[model samples]
Target: MALKAAAALDVELMSTGAFSIDQLMELAGLSVSQAVYRVHPPSAGRRILVACGPGNNGGDGLVAARHLSQYGYEPTVYYPKHNKNELYQRLSKQLEDLNVPFVNDFSKALADTDHVVDAVFGFSFSGEIREPFPAVIKALEETEIPVTSVDAPSSWSIEGGPPMSGVGSNFHPAVLVSLTAPKPLVKHFKGRHFIGGRFVAPSIAAKYDFEVPRYEGVDQVVEVMPGGKALVR
Candidate 1:
């Protein structure tokens, strides 16, 4: 999806009054956590690091980390700049209640964790890599550990995909779980991909002229083939 279209769709969905930010975040985060579990199960390694920013994307990370813990994974959150929004506070509190640890050492996290969840940025992000994140993205680019990014890869443009060179250039996420629908930047990604956000109404999809993946049963997401087909089995 184009950047504008994606933003507009979010607005339209909220206007319908059938959904709230909390509901959407929970579903999207669950889908993200499910994707992580599917690709890198707890049997592989239980210590997962979730890197969260200060936006809605970070909220998704918080929610995903919570679900990961419920699924029996030892998940840690790396939240540098926290969002003060009530929704985000509640999400963080849920993790605290679960006894999940929050860390500030990105270097130690990179060395200690098995997998990383890149929820530091979303489709709305633009411009050069900012403070705190430069070190985070740099560490990620240099790490051998696999990553599962939620929505958009951190520091990537919604239209241009990953940067050609510099901080985010060499950082390739092993898995990407796009919410609502795959954005235009996905065309440049060559990895395991999945689409979450099953809340898109049929009329909204038709109005936007995009196809929603046929989610099986009560599944929250479906794998998207490189050719853009949903692997619905």
Candidate 2:
């Protein structure tokens, strides 16, 4: 359902030349903030650390930080670098305008955060985490605070394999806030066991009439072959 909605929106947005990449980034950020609010209700004096990457994922984090600030939560954004990309530059400037404190170091920034928002990676990632970000991942692993990942963990793979499957234990987000539908990586990978034990697909709200149903009754059912006689006495 989430995939369908995302595809629909992608088509509509792509058709319009006016729709820019920045708009999509903002939408993703806002969606993640909403999910955070749903999972962990806002409280007084709570601190949130939003870890952003260098790409659009970082932009999403910046947007979420802005929204979180408006809700009266103190949000600190951490980005790897502020480069020349127009969208990225815009987000950096926005964060500055909002007076949101941000840093490039993962260890120091995550020191006292109550909640960690993983906007460091998105669905577009395919290979292993490179460079200093791997260090950042390692640092996040050591922290005991709850984590909320945006879309899916950065290194998760749709295709079944060693590295793909191996990453399940690496990212243990307390709640995985998917944008549209839950990605195949989120379902196939053991992320539910590790980081995001609570799987949340927020786009379902826009696509479906009823609320997303929780998994139930798997233990109560028994499979029977066609034309087989009942085993019960």
Query: Judged by TM-score, which candidate is best?
Result: 1
Write out the backbone clash pairs for model 2: 2-181, 172-194, 172-195, 173-195, 173-196
lDDT, candidate 1, equals 0.90
Q: Give one digit per residue, the lDDT tens place, for model 2 in 46-124.
A: 6899988876667778888888888777889888665588778877788788888877667887887788888877766
Q: Which stretches of model 1 miss by more than 4 angstroms?
A: none
Q: Say which candidate scores most in lDDT.
A: 1
Candidate 1 to truth, TM: 0.97
Per-residue error for 10 in candidate 2, Å, reads: 4.0
